[model samples]
Target chain A: MSVLTLEDVNSYYGNSHILFDLDLEVEQNEVVALLGRNGAGKTTTLRTITGTVPRREGRIEFRGEDIADDSVDKISNRGVKLVPEERRIFPTLTVTENMQVARDMSSGNPRDIQEMYDVFPVLDELRENRGRNLSGGEQQMLSVARALIQDPDLLLLDEPTEGLAPVIVDDLYDVLSEVVAEDVTVVITEQNVDFALELSERAYIIEKGANAWGGTVDELNEREDLLDEYLSVGGAEAD
Target chain B: MVSLGLVFDQLITGLTIGARLFLIAVGLSLIFGVLDVLNFAHGVLYMIGAYAALWAIGAVSIPFIGLLGIGFWPGLVVAILAAGLVGVLIEAGFIRRVYDREPLDQLLLTFAFVLMLTDVVKTTFGSGSNVVDPPGLLAGSLTLTSSLSLPNYRAFVILMSIVVLAAIFVVLQTTNVGRLVRATSSDRDMAALLGVNVPRLYTVVFFVGAALAGLGGALAVPTQSITPALGNQVIINAFVIAVIGGLGSFAGAFVGAYLVGISIAVGSLIVAGAGQLIPFIAMIVVLLLKPEGLFGGAEA
Candidate 1:
């Protein structure tokens, strides 16, 4: 069974229709990437699953329960966390406070944020620093680490590596792999198709708000023609 | 040149006024910081508290202190509840619908409510001014200098303000609920996913903010006469304080309040006309330079 499922979800912003009957799912211990170009509703898909944007007509089920109408706070307390686009870390708060804020959300004991810091050793060095002071890569690491401390059942990350150095990309991949090993399910939306594929075991590609293709990482790797046609990356020979 | 005693008198008066501004401005900062709404009708909420206290004390028979205690205390509590209820009604009925609307539309709605509330008080209370005398225990004057005397009520207001700040500090810095409140203000949607009851929190925050305004009005009634427009003069000052302190910075509110308080006091002594506008001038400079108040970081 899927850990997180969105069935026929439709989301609207005022009169504008952004998400149209989109269906997606993430299974236990799986890293699934939602890939699309700008304005393709990738962010909205993540928001809808987490109940940030109102779903006009759809059902969102997480971990065997219907949670479409549940409050975002309620949905999150059930161990679902979202690291929003733009690395929405409280820039005013120190790394420790930001983590504490996330930890304080649920009623129980918080997950060990140290393990996250251990994975992103740079963040451990800058724990006393404000989130804004950190480089783009460090802020993204803080965002991911803060979410992990919640011991989330399903994690939603949007554009985790939109603007980062090449070296930071390797660090993010390491963290993503470690997260899945802890039995956490992840659904990440990414504009960087290469970066997403490096970390995600499964992939869903969309164009203009509709699901264009859905398959495993190996299938996407083999189908270079499909990637070149939709994502404009490269065909089979480009590698 | 004034003597040492004269300076002390002004210092005491400054503390009283500073504390009052702090209580009122802190709420304004919190409301604005979290939702980014200006709450133009905040003054009306204050007026409601003053009028509520007047009615409660007049209708119910009690001793002066009891009237002072139960009157302003209970009346302030009720006013806060009423203001919060009104806030929820406004939010659910109007603000909620305009959550995504342009800022101007929301401002216009709140401005309209301000006018409506002012009219409501004018019709109910008439144009007459009402004054609730301080309880005899808190009525006497403190003879700080041979000639200068300070009212006990003013001192009480100052003490209560400090107490209120201390309590809020405990909650915001140490408690779980306080942490949740801070987190939500930082990133609301993420806070929700972390299991914060945001709508309920919004309602609570609105009510608390309204209550603080109401409490300000109730406290003011003993020292000053109450009228429909009594809150109007104070609200702008409170806004200036909130802006100078940086909308959501709790400690910033105190800094802004005392800075403005001392400036206004000292300004009047130097140049009465310009002194009154010192806070505004300071605000102008602040916005021009920082735009975000002293303590506000990126959220500013």
Candidate 2:
């Protein structure tokens, strides 16, 4: 069953159009990657689903409910969690406090604090540390852990592996792969093709606010010209 | 060195005044922090609180509260609740519409509220000085040292201010709701995505800020005379304190209030107009030395 679907979504900042006729879908337990270079509407597409984009024209269905007109908080309460590109951690708050703020109390979320620590043991070490004190990798882990604490069914992560060391990326891939095991659908936007392909089963290449291609990771690996045309990355050998 | 007794006396006086300033300025800082709006009408709330207390105490009797024997404590309580209610109305009726607009727009809108409030006070109480006698327990002075005789009301105001400060600190620092507020203040959009009701939070913040202003006004009624333009005279100093401490910082407000209070208390002893000039001078110096004020970091 499709867990999330966006049909002909168009988003804009004032008069400047960012997403044009963007259509995407994710099945239950699937990992989907929205791949594009900078300013190609990948982030905007995720933001549209999260209801952060101000001017959005489209139909967004999460599970079976249409959430096109819902406010950001209402959309979030419906179990759609977005770990934004900025991460948006409260710099003044401790790591545990950050996680606590996103707890899904409405669903009586069974995910405990220790469960989150089990996923990112680094968070356990830095539990009392404030968000401002965390390193980039630690911040990313905390960001993902915070969303996980919400026990969301559909997790929208923007540029999860950006500016991270390979080892940290590997660790994150392991954590998310485990999350995917529990039937949670994840839609991630990325410029890192290797990282995206490693986690995502299906990939959609968005170019200039429209869908350029949609296929499996294997199909994307064979099309060097498609990668070069859309992502500015050379090909499979680029990784 | 100057006599230690004289310095001690001035310090006590500074603290009493600082307590009142903290009450007003902290609310200003909090409103700015969470709402990202500079409320020029905050001073007007202070003015309303003073008048409300005066009405409650039978100093100036309107139709509703003048006939009752609502003494000092009840009067102050009424003033705070009334001011907070007015704030809720203002935030819902006016400020909510301008939340996403420019700061200039918010400023002008709040400034309009200030004018309207001032006019309402003038129409109701007339343009005369209204004084509220201290409560019976706080009316007299208690002699401390040979030269240190503290007015009981002033001491009470200072002590009460400390209690309020501690309460606010505990609320913002320790509670779950406080955590939500702090998170919202850091990033409104992110807070919403975490299922925080941002609009309701904004209203609560506005109400709390207004209530603090009202409490400050009621406290000031015993120490100073209430005039329609009392808000105008005090607001500039409150802004100076908020800026000198950092616009949205709680600790900054606490320290900045004392700095401005002590400077004014000490400066007035030296020169004729130094009390007024020192606060502005301190603000300029702080701006020159630490552009973000003492406690302000990257958020400034």
Candidate 3:
């Protein structure tokens, strides 16, 4: 029941090798988190799976089909949506327009707009406001809402909680919990250890560009030395 | 007191020229904004449109159900369609390859297309300047003042351009397709993640942009000289307008067209040959003052 599997995947940026023999998997409706400090290849792993970062070697399978050579748009067509770290929202477009455009691009009957509004009422209140006018937290919400409207079978979120207020991060955690309840498989990369552990069922600690270790969230919580050496702190919100 | 009538005449002339410039420059701006491709062949697309209209009307005329051959209107339609189709083909065949290449590579690729397109037109139509009469409905002059008169065709061109502008605005602002276009133009990577087929969208945008340029060329038939170098003649000025307005900016193109057009018109009035230099000066001034161009701060 593995919805996505990246086996011994290697990725590069120009000549510099980024991800090295990275291995990961997400099961049906499973919530998995990739945790590491900056430059640990967590983001690159998510990108490789989404086909944004070209994998130099190994296999990436989604729904039991290899997708290592598939184009970014093609992978997206197979219901893989990525909310990147930068939260690249169209600043000139209104909030509603951003979500509507995503919904229009996806196949099948449109997801109910009311459901989106209900999930993020702040988005509804600022529906007519342009993307540039939104605060950082609001932009993050809009970015996440855009991906959600696509109704993807596999959601890839990279650093969704990066640079957000603790309160906003808590709100995002709540929204994502609701999303998980809807049975969409998610693979999120995070530097905030507590936040990642709070949402994900399992954790993979990435060291440099390869997988260092992975186990259940409870198992990760028990390994204080492993967390300290890779994630910079033994406990708490150490990135 | 001399008279305000001459000034009115010049204003009307300026508007006509601005409308034509807007047509060519808007497409250039759109292409740059979305695809990040500086299409040098856009001017040639305009030239192709002019030549296509001429050939459609005079050389190879299509027989209507009842009429013997096609007229100027049908020829104009053909010219637009031909230019748009050619744009799509070029985008798919040549420009698409350079999207991921260096900026210089893209410029060189498009510049090569320009040279090839120019030679093709020269070979097909000969290098000599030609003329095509305006449609009968627009074949006269309208007397706007006691001493001022406007060519009916120029008036028609201005009005038609306004309608096209309104349509473009409506499509980009108030429609779902426009939202997708805006989204794609804003961030292609993000749009792709949203499941937008960006390559196909790019092709459509290039087609629309080329078609607009072609329409401008067709409209110029009765007003401007038809020659192989016609594209070379107006393209620099069009680039200046796009730069002054801001590359990839709709409102920038709109305002830049008029700024350049009116400067040329009024400059001609003040000094003999200053009209030619005015647009460049305006471009330099805009660049020095606001490096992003007037409307280039963000894509619309």
Per-residue alpha-carbon lDDT of candidate 3 for residues B121-175, written as tens digits (9 for 90 to 100): 8876778887767889888899866788888888898898788778888999889
**TM-score, one value per model:** 0.84, 0.93, 0.93
lDDT digits (tens) for residues B1-300 of candidate 2? 567777777777788779888888888998999899898888889889888888878788664534445788998899899889998899989999999899999999999998898998898778899776799978888988777788889889888878887888899888888888888999899999888879999999999999999999999888888999998877888899987999898888888888888888877777856887998988999899998888886342
What i-RMS does every model get?
2.1, 2.3, 1.2
Segments of candidate 2 deviating more than 4 angstroms: A104-110, A218-225, A235-239, B1-12, B63-69, B145-147, B298-300
Cα miss at A109, model 3 (Å)? 4.3
Model 1: CA > 4 A from native = A13-21, A37-39, A54-59, A69-71, A107-109, A191-195, A235-239, B1-15, B59-93, B242-252, B255-300
lDDT of each: 0.77, 0.87, 0.86
Q: What share of the true interface contacts does each candidate keep?
A: 0.76, 0.70, 0.84
TM-score of model 2 (CA atoms): 0.93
Candidate 1: give the clashing pairs: A72-B192, A73-B192, A73-B195, A73-B196, A76-B193
Model 2 CAPRI rating: medium
Best candidate according to DockQ: 3
In model 2, the fraction of reference contacts reproduced equals 0.70
Give RMSD (Å) of candidate 1 vs. truth: 4.3
lDDT of 1 by residue, A102-199 (tens): 77774555777677677778888998898769888989998888888887778888998888898898878887877777777888887678878877
Ranking by TM-score: 3, 2, 1
